[model samples]
Every structure is written in structure tokens, then in C-alpha cells.
Target: MDDVIIPVAFFLILAGAVVAVAYFQSLRNRERDRQWADAMEQYRVVVERARTEQEATKLQLVEMSHQVKALEKLLLSVD
Candidate 1:
């Protein structure tokens, strides 16, 4: 009876330890995933802002080109 009891107790303790380790590992993985998601969101916001700025610059360049063309026409008429 004593021998059987010792082996049973040992096995129970081992199983409990494995469960504890698994639970803690899952919590760590969840935290890591959350951090990665936050980083990705920040990157997305920065990219979007850059795209908007580029579009504004392109528009400004187009307007400047039109103004230059008008000036050239005026100079030609005067000559």
C-alpha cells in the first residue's frame, strides 16, 4: 500500500507542474501577440500619413507648372 501511494503522489505532482507551466506559457504568448499588434497599427498610421503628404506635394507641383506656362505665354505675346 505504501509503495503504491508514493508513486501515485509523484505522478500527481508532475501533472500539476506541467499544467502550471503550460498556463504561464500561454499567458506570455498572448502578451507578445498583443504587443506585435500594437506595433503594426503604429506602422500603418505612419504609412498613411506619408501617402497623404506625397499626394499634396504632387498637387502643388501641378499647380506650379500651370503658373509657369501662363508666364511663358505672356512673355511671348509681349515679344
Candidate 2:
């Protein structure tokens, strides 16, 4: 009876420790997942901003091209 009691107590203690470690690990994983989601959202915003800037730049270049063509026609008429 004494031997059985000792083994049972040891087993219970070990099981409790294992459960505690697993619980903490799960919490850590949840925090990591949240961080990853936030980073992805930030990345998406940055990409959208870059796309908008690129479109604005493209419009400016097109406007500049048109202005240059108008100038060239003016010079030809002067000649």
C-alpha cells in the first residue's frame, strides 16, 4: 500500500506539471498568432498606399507627355 501511494502521488504531480506547461504554450501561440495578423494588416495598408502613389505618378507622367506634345506643336507652328 505504501509503494502504491508513492507512485500514484508522483504520477499526479507529473501530470499536473505537463498540463501547466501545455497551457502556457497554448497562450504563447495565441499571442504569436495575433502579432502575425497585425503585421499582415500593416503590410496590406502599405501595399495599398504604394499602389495609389504609383497611379498618381502614372497620371502625372501622362499629363507631362501631353504638355510636351503641345509644346512641340507650338514650336512647329512658329517655324
Candidate 3:
């Protein structure tokens, strides 16, 4: 009976230690996930801003092209 009791106690202690380690590891993983989410959000904002700037640049180029075409037509008329 004594031998059986000692082994049972040891097993219970080991199980408790394993559970504690797993709990701490789970907390660390949660923190890492939160940080990754924040970084992804920031990246998304930057991409949106770049897309807006690119659209504005394209519009400006189109307007400039139209002005150059009008000038060419006027020069031909003068000639």
C-alpha cells in the first residue's frame, strides 16, 4: 500500500507541472497573435494610402496629356 501511494503522488505532481507549463505557453501564444494582428492592420492602412496616391497621380497624368494634345492642335492651326 505504501509503494502504491508514493507512485500515485509523484504522478499527480508531474501532471500538475505539465498543466502549468501549457497554461503559460498558451498565454504567450495569445500575446503573439495580438501583436501580429496589429501589425497587419497597420500594413493594410499603408496599402490603402498608396492606392489612393496612385489613383491621383494617374488622373493628373491624364489631364496633362489632354492639355498637350490641345496645344498641338492650336500650333497646327497657326501654321
Best by TM-score: 3
TM-score of each: 0.85, 0.88, 0.89
Off by over 4 Å in 2: none
Candidate 1: regions farther than 4 A off: none
By TM-score, is 2 or 3 better? 3
Candidate 2's residue-wise lDDT over 1-79, tens digit each?
Answer: 9979999999999999999999999999999999999999999999999999999999999999999999999999999
Tens-digit lDDT string for candidate 1 (1-79): 9989999999999999999999999999999999999999999999999999999999999999999999999999999
* C-alpha lDDT values of all predictions: 0.99, 0.99, 0.99
Q: Give each model's clash number.
A: 0, 0, 0
List ranges where model 3 is wrong by over 4 Å: none
The ten-residue window of minimal lDDT in model 3 covers 1-10
Native RMSD of candidate 3 (Å): 1.2
Better of 1 and 3 by TM-score: 3
RMSD of each: 1.4, 1.2, 1.2
